[model samples]
Target: MNDPIRGTARGSAPAPLSVLDTALAGRGVSAADALSGSIALAELAERRGFTRYWVTEHHSMPGVSSSSPAVLLARLTAHTTRLRLGAGGVMLPNHPPLIVAEQYGLLQALAPDRIDLGLGRAPGTNQATAAALRRGRSDDDFPQQVVELLRFLDDDFPEEHPYRERVYAVPGPGQDKENGLPQTTGRPSVWLLGSSGYSAQLAARLGLPFAFAAHFSPDHVAGALRLYRDRFTPSAVLTEPYALASFAVMAADDEHEALRQTRSYAHSMMRMLHGKSYLVPTADEAASYPYTASEQLVLDRWTNTVLHGTPDRVTVHLDRLHEAARPDEIMIASVGHTPQALLRSTELIADAYTLPSTPVPVSAR
Candidate 1:
């Protein structure tokens, strides 16, 4: 029997690509520098005609600076005009649903149509950090939290709901008024992000778009997508199932250099696995680090999930991934030892795929 997943040949039309930045600090770089790098990359992505520019949320990590996506997005809005800014995502379990809605609602008010709210159940941090962030709250009720979040966003609470009359999401959905009530002027588009079938099922059941974190957790990509499509139901937000598959990618002029840049990511992962701070190391440092056979195996497994090569080779790899997953959109999570290399990788991929260079109109923004 043939494999369930299909494969696309080289030179095929590429799917829409977007960028997912973690604001990873390079060796000897400060978090401020990393954030500046993220803004520069978003500007580049906008110029390259990429679909969206998403920043992730992480806590207490020396190498990552995107601790608060909403705050970062607020800064990003001043630097970018047309690129869609979003949290790739905010760990919903870490925050109250009302606050999440209010924050994203304010974002929408700031940039209007160019805002997205990607919600995830994961703490986006380690267990100890998760505990500190949660502060005695239970994350076991994720489904209920999601429902409540949606209700807050839509201002759709029932008449008898206790909070319905007591609270309201400011700058509500749109400019529609009734009985002299101030109409809601903005609401960010929401998406469910996950690396497992549970999130897929939830997104499908709720009719929200789903984004799978194949970049780090490759094992569940196929299963999650399958479950999502198989069980999807239409909702007011989405008429049909829409899924985005995020992949770790690095492309360069030379295949060897591209592969070398990935060594830093490998070292970072190894550190994370060993319960060490995941500060990105230099390529030379990563190369010189001694590893046991078992540790080497772990590194190899983690690195295998990333696509790294010359632009031509990387393009072919992306094509195959698109064919197999059949996601509506493809999101690239690019990392490197240097800011220049990371920006160059994105540029090379955009050129390889012949992505448009036109910016979204200011009128649209």
Candidate 2:
């Protein structure tokens, strides 16, 4: 097989690649099994030289098992070594800043430098679930909440600040000496995730790393990148702008087989668009579904977001995306009919990119 991803970017260094798993439930597979699959995939990604293994947050979705990224990441920490595990991300609007800070602070305390907290303003579920999660709170406070969360994480609140003395982000920056707990130095690497210019500008102004969700929302990628770059300023977290763009990909040994794997993903998205249960259908089931002309148009648009082909062909498409987006890293979101197929697609892409495999360290668990 010809390696299409062999060369470096056009006049630039080869960008790092990472994996984003949503733990999509397959046909006849239980949610527990899907989560196990995610763990297996993360283990594979670590051995395959992938930079990071990120799990997504989605609530009330029967197809996705990753409703709580923090909880899942805690489990993943004991299962794999050398792979940066994180929420990619935790929706900020769904929880209070203090709670988010403390949870991730504990995670960092456990894993040290291997934890990342990618924050997003969007709710990770449907309207009903969002209401339940937020209780009656408005999302208008997102920017302020972000600032508060960062302050708590860094323990940078000034003496005059109202919450400075009253609230300490326990197990975080300011630990109580009376409790006899050793002061922790672990701090999570924070990244802002978004699909629009609003988050791009905020992330830039805050000087944090940014990850754009171009895998689903491709319309605003270029503009968001430009805005982030133009508005970025040096901060405590970063000296320069670093951006990662995610894309849905499914590579296989043959073009026909690759396209076949994507049918389930397309059908899943179509079901979501129509407010139906978003369970991932089998490829055979997806193919058998009747489609109206309008529905076919929707499916075509949804499936177009996915890069499905043989490894060589997929690599070329990824390279073009890299050239156009100029992101510092490219994150792959691969979904398939079966666990083996998904694993194979990820392996093929990693191999095409010439990623060096590393020996998995003994499980810390």
Candidate 3:
């Protein structure tokens, strides 16, 4: 089949996917301001021919402030004309299914064809924080919640079923009789997000698309895809596995700049490990972090999968990733010590991957 990604000859190619994330310019800017900035950036990505602009959800975060993805997505959706807008993921364990349905349905109502919801099981924070957000819900029951959410979105429960009689998503877009679920006047599309085997298999069994969080999960990238593809049994939505791999793409004018910029992520990762994940700092501020020797080594290891270097250099690695994973789409997450640095990374990545004269016509979004 022809790979929609590049319109090129295909022996084992996946279709081109939409690109970019909503947390475009990292840094401690307020969510409102960041959204405003990202709106312009998304416009740039669209004009540059990138695919999607996915915002992520994180709560009680100081450095990063992407708390309400649905609300932010709606705002960003209003600003951009085309680049598909979505959530890199909303943590399922944190919110009720109906709430998710209602919020996204509202967004879908506003931006019909351009809404997407990628769900992850992680709290995106510490246990205490997750506990606070979840009230009394069981994180152990995430799988069940995922299923329930899917059924709600599909609104596929037959009326004859007793459960269907007493239970229904009041705010569900309604079922598209054809889909046996609530009818969608065209709200957000759903995607399962993962970092390992469990999510991959779940996505397969559910017959929904999957997005792997390769940004901080380089080691499991190939393995997760392997499970996803191996266990996949075609379903109604997809005949084969449709995998999207997210990565930290930090491209700059030079290797040194890229490496230095990556310190932001390293620091953030450290904070996460210790319960203080914050938005990336300014380059000047980042230089001031007193990382211990051991901490530096850990981050270096964690940064293994991150693509850092000039566009040409980064493209070489990206091509290798494509060869190995053959993802339908590649979502680039360029978080740097400063907003300007992050914007530069995104620009350079766009340049490296979007060249009309590049010899390799690979376009995995």
Candidate 4:
């Protein structure tokens, strides 16, 4: 298929498309359904040629059910073969480095080359919850924690290191070879997820891939990416920098419907900003809710940051963003309240980009 807006072949489209998902639970969706929807969407993403599927972590958030990204991603492996599945990030501060390494290590063992372990510095919840999850641990130690986690993943502790030979992530590096297990299931690729320069710089120093969270923090996208490329240092994981930009995008066959969906997301975001219950409102609810002048301004600002419209319009905007930032990949974080809307938006965007859908072989399935 060809790009609808540019009338060019799919290969010419800006960059490879991937997915960033938060198993949203709100309005007509139950928590179980949200998880199930993620599975279905990942399967579709693989068939539609999306590069990878990354689920983010959120804790005790009313409208978010993706509290455990590793668990959700585990389920996805059974449903898809080609799709690269990962935690958009596991909030490192909330759990011990060894635990996080073990979880992802086991995942790598299960999914082989298809797993990714994206790390983030921030706690994905409020202060109270962060305290509860972290106990007395300090978030300021994030960089150190990342190094420790990587060591566990690689099973490469120096002789002088305290944990060398004393600790290990069982399913991690050398496990398969030592135990005579299949070597096909290698370790997960690492990526740093961020909305600022700190994360970009850390990723650069370590020579890991960097994925900017433009979906939430649009203002820093260009600057953060620039810092990453400028300060990059070659390492074993990467010889050069690889950057991925994620954006909140929704595409529909009809422009009006797309607008309504975006408005619904705006209302939900407004509620979140105000520290309200954070349930996603339906499009009809959003359309009928009376907004104060200030609230309307907030809504407008949020909507402007997102790319929403017909498939052609959205793809055009995506191409422009790619040209400006020059990310190696473009990841779409669909912001629709309902599962069906999310699926439809994904399908429309794939069609617009003419992404080839390779059917899964029966044996693989």
Highest lDDT: which candidate?
4
> What TM-score, over all chains together, does every model reach?
0.92, 0.93, 0.85, 0.94
* Between candidates 1 and 3, the TM-score winner: 1
Instruction: For residues 4-83, write the lDDT of model 3, one tens digit per residue.
Output: 11212121223343454545335656656666566656656565556677777776666565677777777766566555
lDDT, model 4: 0.83
The positional error of residue 151 in candidate 1, measured at the CA in angstroms, is 1.2
**Backbone-clash count (model 4):** 0
Model 4 bad stretches (over 4 Å) = 1-12, 174-184, 363-365
How well does model 1 score by local distance difference test?
0.81
Worst 10 residues of 2 by lDDT: 1-10
Please, what is the whole-model Cα lDDT of each candidate in the order they appear?
Answer: 0.81, 0.82, 0.69, 0.83
After TM-score superposition, the amount by which residue 137's alpha carbon in candidate 2 deviates from its true location, in angstroms, is 1.7
Ranking by lDDT: 4, 2, 1, 3
Candidate 2, residues 322-356, lDDT tens digits: the string is: 88888888888987777667788988888887777
lDDT of 4 by residue, 141-211 (tens): 88899999999888888999988877778777556556766554556788888998999999999988999
- Summed over model 2, clashes come to 0
Which TM-score value belongs to model 3?
A: 0.85
Candidate 1 lDDT over residue span 123-237, tens digit each? 8888899999999876789889989988887888898999775677665652244336665454677899999888899999998889999997876787889899999999876
Candidate 1's displacement at residue 270, Å, is 1.0
Candidate 3 error regions (>4 Å):
1-17, 20-28, 160-184, 277-279, 355-365
